[model samples]
Target: MAISSAVQGVSTAKRQRFLRSTVVLHAAAAVTGLVMVLYLLAHMYGNYKVFSGQVAFDGYSHYLRTMGEPLLPRTGALWIIRVVLLASVLIHMYAVIALWRRMRKATAGKGGRRYQSRKNPRGVQRTYSSFTMRWGGIIIFLFVIYHILHLTVNAIAPGGASESPYERVVNGFSIWWVVATYVIAMLALGFHLRHGFWSALASLGANTSPARRRLFNQTATVLAVVITVGFLIPPVAILFRGVGS
Candidate 1:
């Protein structure tokens, strides 16, 4: 009785602490996600300007750099947002890693008790979402890193990357192979978002009831389509129409 009581007490204490930390981390992720979504939307719009030609695309980038420049010389708005985004991504990764390790430990501790009984744990399964949880996240993380390096860091982009965003995109996409790579990555992003977008709402408390969950799922679907199409437009335009003067 005493051992069980002690274990119960410890469990409750740990639960309380875990909840507190999760609440803090989740709030940070949600807020930063919304902010990052805004930046991504703006970026998609700017890239979409490729329809008009390189000048229009590059001009849009210049406007982004110089917007509220001398007045807000800190460039604080954009850089600050980027920093927050980085932090949020770190926190998100840590949370998942921590949870994953805990689950792994728990699985190891099971001692094959169920397996020994020959009850098919494999046959009796959970939802599709449960199956994809581990690998899907890793895939998305890899893709996000590639995305940041390709555009944000301007490292992997084509010639004149820093001097001209338009040229970087055109030269990169004109290769055909590079555009195919992006298309593949975006298709993966579409899959990741299929589950993630709705799940995020549940975490953020938007999916309170069954009806709310349905609405949240619909909203997530729409947002996912918007994001996928918005990103694909610029590359499609560049493929059909030649780039630059």
Candidate 2:
């Protein structure tokens, strides 16, 4: 009997350790995801410069490269930001996988909904944002890779790797297929952000008060819409405005 009790105690301790680690991972992912959201807002702002004219847009791109010039070499600040974002992405993905595994383990024998919120007494149905999160994330991730290749590296430039940032953007959006792809990707991004932003706030302990919770949800919705429209405007404008004339 004593030996059996000891084994049970050890198992409980192991479970506790696992739970603690999962909590830490969840917190880290929430924080990093919020950072990425802020970065996207800044990126969208930069994209809006396209409306000002080719010279303004190109100058904005150039300014990003020389942001911390002299004290830091050209593109130094940009590389630093890239490194930070890359690390955040890796960490965020790791945390997501770990939490997902834990969730699966917990629900192994429970054959009901895999993602229902048990905290709600009414047993409310999941929102579209939550329902589409995983697939939306996949779509956005694939889109980002294609976007970087198409614009950043010129691996698939429409007009043969133009030197002008404005030209590359205009050239890419000139294609109907590219504009269509961008619209789909932006829609996915909007849905992802809608859920992700509010969830991040909850994870960070901002949902304690009813008012705070409502504000967080509203802010998340606004952010999702603003970013989605801001990003879509450039490509849509270029497509309809005639790329060079």
Candidate 3:
């Protein structure tokens, strides 16, 4: 009996440590997600400058590379932002993947039954946004790589290669298939952001009351709409409206 008690106590301690680590990972993922959201907002703003014309757009792009001159080398500030974003992406992905594995393991242990919520009449706590979260993330990941290669690296230009950032925007979006791919990716991003924003806030302990929950839901919806629309406008306008032309 004493040996059994010792083993049980050890198991309980290990479970407690695992739970604590899971919580930490949740917080880390939430914080990193918020960081990426901020970056997206900033990037969306930059994308809007394309409507100001090629010179203004290219100038803004140059400013990004030359930001903090005298205080830092050319592209130094940009590199700093890039490094921070990369670290955030890595940490966020690691935390999310780790939690997801644990969730899958727990579900398997429970005979593959998903936890049900009282709020859900279907006996499942799933939302459309949550349902598509993993797949949407995969789509977004692929889009990001293609986006970087097409625009940033100038290695996989759809229409043609160009040194001008504004030209790149106009050329790439001018292609029908490119625009379609972008639209699909943006829609996926909207769904991802809608759920991710609320989840992040909840993970950070912000969903305290029903009222707060409603507000967070609305905020998440608005943020997702704004970011998704904001990003889509530049490409759509450049393609159909001939804004850059």
Q: Per-residue lDDT tens digits of candidate 3, residues 1-245?
A: 99999999999999878755988889998999999999999999999898899999999999999999989999999999999999999999999988888888988844234566777655566679988988999999999999999889989988888999989989889988999999999999999999999999999999999999999999999999999999999899988865866
- Model 2: lDDT of residue 227: 91
Number of backbone-clashing residue pairs for each candidate, in the order shown: 0, 0, 0
lDDT of each: 0.67, 0.86, 0.92
**For candidate 1, what is the TM-score?**
0.73
TM-score to true structure, per model: 0.73, 0.85, 0.88
Best first by TM-score, ranked: 3, 2, 1
Index of the highest-lDDT prediction = 3
Better of 1 and 2 by TM-score: 2
Q: Which lDDT value does model 1 have at 201?
A: 65
lDDT of 1 by residue, 121-152 (tens): 54443334444655766776787787677766
Full-model lDDT, candidate 2: 0.86
Error of 2 at 81 (Å): 0.5
- The RMSD (Cα, Å) of candidate 3 is 5.3
lDDT of 3 at 211: 100
